[model samples]
Target chain A: MRSRGAGTRTQLTKLEELLRELRVEEVMTRRLVSVSGDFTMAQVKELLRKHRISGVPVLEGEALVGVVSIEDVTRALEQGEMGAKVRDRMSREVITVFADEPAVEAVKRFAHTKVGRLPVLDRGGKVVGILTPGDPVGRAFRVMDLRYREQEQQRWQQKGLGLEDLLGEGASLVLRFRVQGEDFAGAGKASVQAKRVLGRLGLDPGAVRRATIAAYEAEMNLIIHTRGGELTLEATPHSVVVEAVDKGPGIVDVEQALQPGFSTAPEWVCEMGFGAGMGLNNIQSCADEFEIESEVGRGTRVRAVVHLSQSGRKDRLNR
Target chain B: MRLQDIKVQLEAEQVAGSPRPELEIKEACAADLMSDVLASARPGSLLLTGLTHPQAVRVAALASLAAVVFVQGKEPLRDTLVAAEESGLPLFVTQLSLFESCGRLYQAGLRG
Candidate 1:
């Protein structure tokens, strides 16, 4: 049980000495793709497709204003809660590294920090490029480990692909995908795909972001916190709806369920950098119209709606 | 007013998640949950809450709050207090209900 057959898959963490040898200037991927805070969501989507990056730094005339990730873009297309403003969902006060420092330091920072990207700067603080520790070779090995084992595969199992499984034939534009609940490896995939759907349909980015956050939270709720629920993505010309119904033991208190800090997830969730108890509240925060009904003995139903035509909203930045 | 002034109004105990004593204060907000407080609290404000965990401290850091007051004489967990200590934030403890504590601070010029 201790090994769980994870022997060959385990890769050692980088030592501090290795980190100390890493200089920010050495490993950074040069030629950053940046967007102004005023850039349209359509333009940002194009940038992601072109650069093949998960995020882009948002510049307010070179003050290093904020950053837009694939997650932000997805949220915009899904619910449009954050509006067309890039500053709304962008992470301000981005973590950074100096070129004179060791390259391994970037890896250490990435492992420790909540954010995924670090902008590299030289002595004078001019932007050099970026560094992302994504798709580590070790990870590819771990993913390959799960490829053959049926017992291990059960954790990430899916009944089928596409929305028809969760919602009947009446559901339109059925968006379907599997939840990597146990691994937490690809939890947001479903929501991100749904966001692209909205963008292609010319839905507002503001609405897209909101709906995506709510939907992602719900999907994560199913994957991480509950016993795993199914997702139903149904959209019409005027509104987008996400329905997540999980067969967990069901919520204990609807009132407390609506309140924040009301998480029942184990402590390791926090250790692994997931489950901040923001799941339910974040869902409530973004959706234009939200409804939830759960029975203690059975399951839970969360329905969220986002309109198609809402305009810009003032997005806040946190230092 | 500065943090030293607000120290006089607290219940004279160090609750677990309460920030340190030296950090400066500019305003105050009293809430138990993480979401609305994150959405509403201003920068450099003092936060009063019943939540005694690291997430609260994380929000406090993200919002750039100066101090966190634990009302009802509640003790913050070790992790929360440790985060506050690491952040060098001021921690204050008060033996009062959420309503009365907020009311007393409002009377003392700690505007919402």
Candidate 2:
């Protein structure tokens, strides 16, 4: 199925044309998770754990001085180095790539060094962004999706087919499936359908994976906890949204259920290897945007959106 | 280290899912506790555990782990294998104990 009505298709085509000239500055994460060199081990550990990141750059003034990673922290904790400063434990000889460099260069460095992230530097050699192993690939897939969509649009135009004619009269594809309570056999159907729709739309595989996982988790939650539910999958040119609406017995405590390892699921759900209480947490982590609302006797609603774009930065020229 | 190289270093065998030998193993977390894994596991890192259940695969999928290495020669059940396959999370089995497996990966520079 194919249709373009949101005008994101136009933006995507422009992105595709710009992709060939892509640079690290355009795709790198500008909001860097960096620490001061004078930060204590306790402080650094807290930062890393809070962000759920493996490593962080150490900055002394505007200069990129070092990197403190999980390995360094683990080694420090093991050897009673917990009280020392980050400068004392960080790898001083840091490897960095310039933001003006090509994205492929960053990919090669990540692949060769096996490093989880690299601090991106500006012309002044200051850390301006951080590039992870996934960033380049994410950008690449977004470019590919845009290119494919552009080509599909051109083909349809040449064939003189209207957008509705191509996608069965819709700006977005909506997939709805009824989820039966305790229906373990049918749990993943909605998720699978959502994934297929995303893939057919030529979204980035990582985005598809994340959306599929979130949808699967939400589907499982409805199947296990509620009496019955409806799973809705909505796919757009720029994003995919999945909403799981279930009939009561709504959650007594939504926040507690979002906590990892806090499950109210029965023994059978546990036996199936789910109900770890990680479902909601995982869904939130996987989604670019996530929300859950529940009332005691009313139903629960989970809505998650995974974007098909890279970096979520719409400004191409200024940045 | 690459996952295939890690497999070879540990003399492990691929039991289920896609064998992405070329995929890099940036960091690793060795644990049997799901809570710890969820709390500490970095995305694209390797997970070395003794837990051989479907939960293990589910955890790997949720955490976006690069791969799972089962220690102590244990094997995951059929349901776990199916989950791993469905999630596209690579699974490997090693005869070495959890401590030994972690030590080897650590010696080779796998964090934790």
Candidate 3:
């Protein structure tokens, strides 16, 4: 019994993690079927039967005033109070969940309150949707199934790849991203996308990490230095290549820029925890093969390649 | 150390995402610069920073950090919280300074 309890606990933890990744808005029913407070319980009974739902929220304008459930409808009919208004018959203490709150919160409320549904509200206290117990569970199961399939696909792909075959055929996968300069908020978006794509390709974990780091650095340089540029990631079975190309306001001295801790970034840039002069150095160290070329008036182009077989190599400076 | 232990060590208040107390945190990197965190922080390591910008959350997500702890009781900006929610990156705030937070975690046997 103790071991069984332990197993259940672990499973619950896993489920909880998945739930944390999801929001109430994602799992809740958005096509809300609601009736106004003035509607008769007889009317609510008809609405519930028409929608085949167990419950509906009673709204006063946009505000959720109460909940009228199937049980209430039955009681109203039995007590010969079918003509009573929903506002008087409905349960006023309606438990609610926030639309933006983690889905787990709704699960907790469901567990403790034993309610069939909870109206989901937005930050402004407006009813947006309703969450049923099955919604989160169904969503969690779907997400878990999807994740399992992805992992299986990654494993199958990884097993199918052979270095010789890849090199002989010269087949490669390519991904491209456009980076906008001075878009601090939008920075790192490309690298994150690249990292996910590489992971899905089933590359070596270390290789993926190195490639992601290099891609992020290159993406950053594009955002900080140029007006805009494009980042290209080309992947073969044996290697991952990251390239960043920008149009103008190029570097004057490529050698100086390559030096560690040498940054030409302004004070505002430094305060944001960037322009530490580590971008190029980071890319150089992560890549098994690194190259940089710039024409003073033209833009800079940096490329870094991480070999799959050399995934064991550590980031020298970082370690 | 588990995230629960680190939370206790720093007396952190989770501001975004749900807590995974069982989540293992083997290392941590403390830096305000997103670039530094990207260059050095290992995947699954915790990030300790004073920067509450959304970019900090983005950097943590991009770098695959386990979580982000904002030191000095600094609540993240609204956009940062939104980013955290979107990325599923757990965020915490501590009244402790960055130095003190790091010290507490180190004392609790969490390595950098």
How much is B112 displaced in model 3, in angstroms?
1.5
Q: What's the best-to-worst order under lDDT?
A: 3, 2, 1
Report lDDT (CA) for all predictions.
0.64, 0.75, 0.83
Please say which candidate is ahead in TM-score: 1 or 3.
Answer: 3
Compare the candidates by lDDT and give the number of the best one: 3
The regions of model 3 sitting more than 4 angstroms off are A1-168, A310-319, B17-19, B85-87
Docking class of 2: incorrect
Leading candidate by DockQ: 3
Per-residue accuracy of model 1 over A1-319 as CA lDDT, tens digit each: 6685464234333233334543454345555688888887767888899978888888776667777888888888898653477766677878888767776667668889867788877777677677787522222333233333323323222322222332445665657655545545445557755754554444444565566656777776787766777887666544578789877678889898777677777776555444567777777776678899998869899998876553322122221
Which candidate, 2 or 3, would have the higher DockQ against the true structure? 3
**In model 1, what lDDT does residue A317 have?**
22
**Cα shift from native, residue B2, model 1 (Å):** 33
DockQ (Cα-based) for each candidate: 0.04, 0.03, 0.37
Error of 2 at A125 (Å): 59
Question: Mind giving the per-residue lDDT tens digits that candidate 3 earns over A1-319?
Answer: 9999998898778788989988887677656899998999889989999989999998889988999999999999999999999888999998999988999999999999999999999999999888889988776765565566557746745575443354456778888998999888888878877777666555665777788889988988988888999999988867889999999789999999999899998787788888899999999978999999999778899999988754322222232
